[model samples]
Target: MTAALLAGVLAGYGIAIPVGAVGTYLVSLTARTTLRTGVCAALGVATADGLYALAATLGGPALAAALRPVLGPLRWVCVLVLLALAAWGAAGAVRRYRHHRLATHAGAAPVSPARAYLALLGITLLNPTTVIYFAALVLGSQTGDAAGSGERVVFVAAAFAASASWQVLLAGGGALLGRMLTGHRGRLVTALVASGVMTALALRMAVAPV
Candidate 1:
């Protein structure tokens, strides 16, 4: 249970830390609207992550077994994916900064809290990479019986909590986050730091007991 919780938290933060389009939108929307709406949107994102984590936990063992023979190479593939994710995250941040492509949703009217929640949920659900990332991490897992009913609950709950906490933090930041992301140096520094942390995490995975 402890291992599952730890892994779940790490996995949640692992994916959420990358301030991609959705994250930027969440922060930007909050700065433009109310905290209530932002929090709703944050939860929506967390819900999608929770759902994907649940799917990964439920299907991982069987998938892992089927791929056991090729798990070796797949682990390497996962490593590459992680690296690519890190690089892309950094590069995307830079691009957005350079291109002035912040998700302003310019000229769009403000959405209500409920609408914000549903919109964010649908947007997040459309991201196939989120599920693939979770699935790949689950395949490489050796911590606990992720297939167990109780553990799955714990794992999913932890993942949701982790993601929710971060998303909420971003929403809570409001103008501060918006300013940080919009500022030239601040955005670059933040992106570089996030990428570095993720790279470290990927390297740790590369050396996990195999």
Candidate 2:
């Protein structure tokens, strides 16, 4: 059980520590919104991670085999989705900046906590790499037969907890960033930089060897 717990924690951090396009967006979104909303969004990401971990634990080799064939296509889909999000974020930020300058007071629509949660969840779910990571870990660890049900539960819970902690820390950093950059130009620059980073990461994903 202890070994399983440790492995799960490692796996969780292994997947979550990489600040990819999703993480970039999460931080930028938090900078634009409230901490409460960011927390919800962060949890949404952890929830998706937990779900993938669970699937890996339960399905093991079969799941990995099934996903292997479609990984290329799924990766393409993820890249496209991320690119679209980057475009949307950049465009929205420009529009908001223009309106702010014009004193029209028209800003981007606020994302409620619930909607933010769902949106982040969907975005994370679309990343097939996450599932592949978990599946590989599960298969490599060979914990399915030896760990038993209780240990598996602990493993899943631990993975979720680890991911949640890391994501929340990211959100906290974003909140601090938002506090530091309260001006219109600062916000616009931050948004554009984040959009550019996300776009670059998405492109990298497209060209990366599968």
Candidate 3:
């Protein structure tokens, strides 16, 4: 159990610490919204991670083989979705900045915490890497045969906790960023930069060898 827990922690951090397109978006989303919404989004990401981990534990090597064939197409879809999100974020930030500058209160309402949670969850779920990472960890560890039911539970729980903690820390950093850049122009600039970073990362993911 202890070894399984440790392995799970390492696996969770291995996947979550990469700070790819999804991580970039999470920080930017938090910067544009409240910490409460950011926390919800963070949980959403952690939830997806946990779900993938669970699937890996249950399905083992067979799951990995099944998913390998679909990875190429799935990655393309992920790239397109990320590109769309980047464009939307950039345009929305500009529109919001203009409205704020003009002191017009008729702009679109802020995203609610629930919606933020669901949106992040969906975005994270679309990333095939999460499942592949989990599957790889499971197969590489050779834990399927040795780990009993309780050990598997502990592993999954530890992974979820580790991921949640890291994601929340990211949200906290984003909140700090939002506080630092409270000005309209500062927020707009930050949003644009983040959007650019996200787009670049998405393109990299698309072109990366599977």
Candidate 4:
């Protein structure tokens, strides 16, 4: 049980710590929207991670083998989605900068909490790395006496809880940062810089060797 708990915690952080496209978007989303929305989005991402972890544990090696063949293509698709998001964020930042008054208007129409959650959930799911990480945990698992159904349940719940806590902390941090940097120039700089970073990361993913 202890090993399974430790494995689940490590697995959660291993997948969450990257702060890749999804993480970038989460920060930006919080900056533009409210903490409530950001929290929902964070939970959405955690939910997806938890689901993938459970799938990996149950499906075992067969599922991993099946996913191996399509990992390359899936990575490309994830890259495309990220690039599109980066483009939209860039455009929004530029527009806000050009029309200072529009910041109020743009921020006024923030996404609802539910919609934000669904959006993040979908985005996280698109990243095949989540499953890959979970699959690795499954492959090397030494749960031993802890491999019972109850232990598996505990593992999944623990992973989800751990992931949700960390993600929520991120969202809170982003919200606090957004408040501190609410100045006109500060907002513009942060938004544009984040967009650029995301675009570069997406391009790197696109060209990366499988």
Candidate 5:
């Protein structure tokens, strides 16, 4: 049990610590919105991680094998999704800057906490590689060769908690950034930069070997 707990925590941080395109989006989104919304979104990400971890624990090696067949397609889909998000963010930033007023993409309503949560959850779920990552870890480490049900449960819970804690910390940092960059120009610059990074990341993902 202790081994499972330790391994699960380590696995969670191992995956969550890598701040990629989604992480950039999370921070930028938080900077544009409220801490409450950001935290909810962060939880959404953690929830995805937890679900992946659970699948890995339950399915073991077979999960990775099953995912391998669709890996390339999934990556393409993820790239498209990320690119769309980048375009929307960039457009929204420019529009808001020109009008000197805060607004969301396409005149959409401001992101509520619920909306943010669902958006983040959907975005995170697009990356099917997360499950493979968890599967590899579970097969090679976490719950060992064959984890019992109780051990699997503990591992999943620990992984979720670890991921949640780290994501919340990131959201807090983004909130701080929002406070610091209160001016329109500052927000505009930050948003554009984030959009640029997100675009580059999406393109990079598209070109990466599957």
Candidate 6:
């Protein structure tokens, strides 16, 4: 159980530590919106990761094999989803900047925390890499053997906790950045840069060999 727990923690951090397109978007989104919203979104992301980890643990090799067949299609879908999201964010930033009321506009519609959570969760779920990552770790840690249900549960919980901590930290940093750069131009620049980065990442993912 301890070995499974440690392995899960390491696996979670290994995947979450990278500040990829989604990470950039999370930070920028938080910077633009309120911290509460950011926290909800962060949890959404973590929840997705945790769910994937659980799937990997429970399904083992069979799950990994099933995913391999559809991975290429899934990757393309993920890329498209992320690109769409980036465009939306960029457009919102542009509109806010042009109006010169970026802050007010950002917080205009009091977004429900539940909705925010669901949105982020849905977006994160579109990321096929998370499942692949979890699968690789499960394969490595299984020691050429299957794990018992108890061990799998511990593994999943550890993975979830690890991912949650990292995501929360990202949201916190974004909230700090937002507090620092509350000006219209600052928000505009940050949002645009983040969108660009996410677009680039999506392109890379799309073109990557399946």
TM-score of each: 0.61, 0.94, 0.94, 0.92, 0.94, 0.92
**Best of the two (2, 6) by lDDT:** 2
Residue by residue across 105-210, what tens digits does model 6's lDDT show? 4436755667778987887787777857866765665722477877788877887888889988999999999999988899888888988999999999988887
Query: Would you list the rank order by lDDT, best first?
Result: 2, 3, 5, 6, 4, 1
- The per-residue C-alpha lDDT of model 4 at residue 62 equals 73
lDDT of 5 by residue, 91-205 (tens): 8888888888765444667799999999988888877557557756756753544889888988889888998898888899999998999888988888889888988988888
Which residue pairs in candidate 3 collide?
Answer: none
User: Candidate 6: what lDDT?
Assistant: 0.81
- Which residue runs does candidate 5 get wrong by more than 4 Å? 103-106, 142-145
Candidate 4 local accuracy as lDDT?
Answer: 0.80
Give the range where candidate 2 is weakest over 10 consecutive residues by summed lDDT: 100-109
lDDT per model vs. reference: 0.71, 0.84, 0.83, 0.80, 0.83, 0.81
Over 83-105, each residue of candidate 4 has an lDDT whose tens digit, in order, gives 88888877777777777843523
Candidate 5 yields a Cα-based lDDT of 0.83
Candidate 2 wrongly placed segments (more than 4 Å):
101-108
TM-score of 2: 0.94
RMSD of 1: 8.0
Give a tens-digit lDDT track for model 3, residues 94-182: 88798775221126667788988999899888896885687687678765656788888988888888999999999999989988998
**What are the per-residue Cα lDDT tens digits for candidate 2 across 122-182?**
9898887796787687678776666789888988888899999999999999889988988
lDDT of 6 at 200: 95
| Highest lDDT against the true fold, candidate | 2
